[model samples]
Target: MSMATYIGLNFSVKLNEDYTEDEVEIDYVFSSEEDRNVVKQKHFTTPYIYEVFEKDEPIWRMNEDQKIHSPHNYEKSKKTFLYLCHLLKELLPKGDYCEVYICWLGEEVEECEGELKFNLNNLQIEAIDIYEKYFIRIEN
Candidate 1:
């Protein structure tokens, strides 16, 4: 019989004002099927970064220095936001007129009967709403 497993996905966004160009960073954790059973038990984490631009000019960028934490970690969330603002300094070429937005995605997983079960959640929408209050809109 095959064992069941669960997987989860999470992400966060931030704005920085100290960068010369807009940027984005996405990170995820996934299970590997190519590894042996013992090795497969370990999850793999992947990180990606991209640039955000508007009208051929950088508008704002995400701060890669920020660390991603579990949803229960409120302190890290605050730090993430602060780091994002720092990156925006240089990314927002439009000066104070430009808006910066940050978002995150989260997922949960469980193991059952030699099988893998996964639950996914998108926290980016909530993050967008929070930033929108500050007059920032996450680019679709």
Candidate 2:
């Protein structure tokens, strides 16, 4: 099975000196199949995965989250969700809270469900299509 994901960044933008507005990408697309095709067919194009490093070690990364597939493909990493957050702290100032929202399509997210605390209304159940997605909200 081909697992696809939609990685979205949600935050607010300053509209004016007196006003700040929330923004979300309804049209932003991050398809894995499309990315794979690009990698296979396009040699000159830049790779999509980007990361920042400190002292030759990465602070954060968005590439494949350590996948080991079948007999040929094998990959692993020491990174975990908590470790990722710890790394993010080096980039973000103190006292900022980040929230991650994950809700899969084809299932009713039934308002405030999961091991982690998150707003159910923010789930936006009807917006999912074409891929199994994961949304991580990085707030500063």
Candidate 3:
């Protein structure tokens, strides 16, 4: 048996802000939890982000030459967005915008099981890169 659910998500990442000071801010927004685990897991990385700042910055930070190290924690849904960020860093220069629009949801396919594809402005990145994409559960 196979099933799939389309969930709506919008992610906007601004890299190397051109403001008076250099800053990186990621905006996360999602609606509803198709199931309970989603709610418990917390779709957004806002909490973990703060934790990184308060506790440690090594997980995701830039060095002297503007290089990012270990910027992702391998969260399913969030992976698509982080993948967007990792790619945007390469194409976009300082103060560039990376907007990811997630529109497709797949499940139980092939031997891999699940996969996710997202639109990164003009570019597209799939979760198959890490094979830890988002998967949902449906209860009757």
Candidate 4:
């Protein structure tokens, strides 16, 4: 069976000064799928903000947090969540706060929620409260 997990990043952008909008992408028709598929397919893309170290172990690996999966997969899931935390830290502004919400809703695991607050001032993860329908394995 395939594993699926939802990964999302939410933050705000505040401009210091007003500026006019630049050129936008004009709507165009594509003759074929290949013609429209200009962007490369990737697990996730964050230009200069963050980079994925391991191609085999993307953040989506956290989907293995199910009872059907082996302990090894679970271990990888744990590690991926750490990477997610680091990614969130890197994406947040120095003085801004971002809410991190990751969920693993597998058959056996049901729904596992990880909520956190990134403390930009100290470069530390301040609040971490994870709730799981099954037994929790990932550490804070």
Candidate 5:
């Protein structure tokens, strides 16, 4: 049997004197523990940076197949958001930054927030000031 959940992502950015916020809600469904495990592993092991810093455009794009799928896939959607954070890093002013939050749509899970910014070298996207309580936990 498949389990269903809704994931919510919210982004707030401060660039110089400007502020921007974006929010997305997703319907997530999975058939088994392995499905959740895959996403969890990628979340812990992958670096936040998706591409080189000098690129002017985002490297992530949804393929035809992804666009045709109903109810966005959880893993793909999460990766897309991560890439967006990188894009935010690129657009941030010298001293500006962005904040991201993740939470379950209807569940009692606590929301997790992280600050996204460039590293000292300004070549990599790094997440700092993170609250570790934010993540999906599946229980049997």
Candidate 6:
């Protein structure tokens, strides 16, 4: 018998304002297959921070909060969400039902997308379509 599993996908994006030197970060979690797929297709933006070292070394890094950008305003964030969903679908077994958890970290409080009461049925179907086109199934 196949074992039941819960899958989690974490996505983040960061945006730095060139003029203000301010940054915006965003994160999203897909708990249900339906929500996951919906989030994947949606368009959002990603924010990034650049740091200069003493030796003139330039480094780009994301915050520990794993915040990307505002999903309500950006398109890249949506793209990142989609990519995450793809990864989750590929990693999970086909026969087992899965519960996903998503967490989005911002400058302040983290925002959540899906709830345990809701399942990602539609999102899972979309993920499967993507998997068929991009992922190759392996036999154990």
Specify the highest-lDDT model's number.
4
lDDT of each structure?
0.26, 0.28, 0.28, 0.32, 0.31, 0.26
Mark the regions of model 1 whose C-alpha exceeds 4 Å error after superposition.
1-72, 94-140
lDDT of 2 by residue, 85-106 (tens): 4444443344443433222222
Global Cα lDDT for candidate 1: 0.26
The TM-score, computed over Cα atoms with residue i paired to residue i, of candidate 3 is 0.20
TM-scores for the candidates: 0.25, 0.27, 0.20, 0.31, 0.26, 0.26
Q: Weakest 10 consecutive residues, lDDT, candidate 1?
A: 111-120
Residues 1-140, candidate 6: write the lDDT tens digits. 21111122232224233333212211222133444343233311212111111111101111112233432322333344344345434543554333322222121122333232212234532222111011112111
What tens digits encode model 4's per-residue C-alpha lDDT throughout 1-140? Answer: 32223222233233224332311111221212322121112211222111122323433334434424655754554565565556445655555433222222223223333333334334332123233321221212
lDDT of 1 by residue, 1-140 (tens): 21112111123245344544323222122323332222223332312122222212111121122223233333344444334444443333332222222222111122211211111122232232121102142211
Candidate 3: stretches off by over 4 Å: 1-74, 103-140
lDDT of 1 at 121: 23
For model 1, give the RMSD to the true fold: 15.9
Output the better candidate (1/4) by TM-score.
4
Q: Once model 5 is optimally superposed onto the true structure by TM-score, how far is the C-alpha of residue 93 displaced, in angstroms?
A: 1.5
Query: Model 5, clash count?
Result: 0
Model 4 clash count equals 0
Query: Which one is best on TM-score?
Result: 4
